[model samples]
Target: MASNNRQNSKMTDDGANVTSTPSHDTRQASSSIHVNNLSYDATEEQLYSSFCVCGDIKSVRIITDRLTGNSRGFAFVEFKNTTAVSDAIKLDGMRINGRPVKITVAQPRNSINDNRVVQNREEYQRNTPSRTRVVHCKKSQYDVYIGRPEYWGNPFVIGKDGDRSDVIRKYRAWIMKKPEMLERAKTELRGKVLACWCKPEACHGDVLAEIADND
Candidate 1:
C-alpha cells in the first residue's frame, strides 16, 4: 500500500496558508471538504456513496499522480450545501475501511495574478499618451481576435493557411475533449454577436458562431 499521502498547500488572499482547490472552481470554502489518510485502494465511487449519506453531493475528485495516474491517498469532495459540509466534517478522524481519515473544509486558492494585472494596467495608463484611449468591455461583448493562419495567429485553427474545414474539425474535436471549454464558450457567447479579426469566409470564427447560434 502507498503509505504517503500527498498534500498541497497554497496561500490565499487573506494571507493565510490553506489547501489548494481547483483553478476553475469558484465555490466557497464551506461547500468543499478535504479528506486525507484515505486507503490507497479507495475509489471515488466508494467515497461518493459514503459521503452522500450525509447530504447531496456535487462532485468527488480523488487526487492522483500526473505521471502514473495512481491514487495519492487524499481527495476533495464538494457538497451542494453548507449543512452537508458540516455533516461531512463530523466524520473526521473516523475509520474508513480500517484507516482513519482526516476531514476539513477546503481552503480557497489566492488570486495573485489579479494584482499583477492591476499593476500592469496602472503602468500602461501612466505611460500612455492622452491621444490614446482605452475601452473596457465585458468579455462576451468583446470581438474575437484571430491572427493569420500561416502566422499561427489563431490557436483554435490548425494546418497551413488554416483551412476552414480543418479549423471546424479541429475545434469540434477540441471542444469534445474539453467539455468545460464548450460549456464556458456556450455561456460567454449567449446574446452576443460573434465576429473574428479575419474575414468571415477565411476564419474559423464562423464555426464558433454556428455553435452559439444553435444554442
Candidate 2:
C-alpha cells in the first residue's frame, strides 16, 4: 500500500504548521487499524495529520459509496509498524473533525485468528436457521463484517478507472474460489439481512449473499 496522497502538514487555527511524518518502513502484516465514527467531511489530509504523530502511515482508505463517492463513515489506516498500531488504539475516543473516533487493530485478511473465527462461524450456522436477505444500509446499522464488501477496494480487486465489471468479477471469484476465507462472512449473513446500495442488479453484496446462503 502507498502512503497517503495528501500533504502530511496542516495548519492549526493559530496559523501554526504542524507536520507529521512517518519514520518507518513500508508496512507490517498486522499494522493496519480500523477507524469508525469519522465525520463525513473528513479527508485523507485530516486523518494523516491526526495519526502521523504516532509513526509512518502506509495508507489511509475511507470506505465510500461507489456511485456517489460519499464517505461510509469508516476507514482503514495502515502504519509502518506494530508500535504505531498500539499508539493509535489510545486515540479510540479522541475527537477528530468534531467526532470521537473509535479505533482498533485491524486483523489481516488471512491470519490464525481468522481460522478460529471460521470455526465459530461453522458452529453458529449449525445452530441457527439459515437464509439471507438484501437491504439498503442505513448509516447506523452497517455491519462492519458482513455489510462491508471484502473486495471493496485495493489488495482485493484492481478495478481500473471506470471498469466496474472487473471489480465485480474479482469479488465474485474471491467468494467462490476461497470459501474458507468467507466463513465469518457467511455466518454473519446466514439467516440474516445485509445492506447494499444496489439491488435487483447483481453486485458484490449479492455475490457474498449467494455464496453465504447456499451450500
Off by over 4 Å in 2: 1-29, 111-215
- Local error of candidate 2 at residue 197 (angstroms): 24
Among the numbered candidates, top lDDT falls to 2
- Top candidate on TM-score is 2
- Compared with the true structure, model 1 gives a TM-score of 0.39
> RMSD for each model, in Å, please?
19.0, 20.6
Deviation in Å, model 2, residue 133 alpha carbon: 12
Clashing pairs in 1: none
The lDDT of model 2 is 0.71
Candidate 2 per-residue lDDT over residues 1-215, each given as its tens digit: 77674447889999999987756664445788999999989998889989999899999999885423568799999888878988889889998899999998897776667899999999998997647666565533444333344443223433452255676777666555554446555566666666665554455766666656764
The ten-residue window of minimal lDDT in model 2 covers 153-162
Q: Give me the runs in candidate 1 sitting further than 4 Å from their true place.
A: 1-29, 111-215
| Candidate 2 residue 10 C-alpha distance from true site, Å | 60
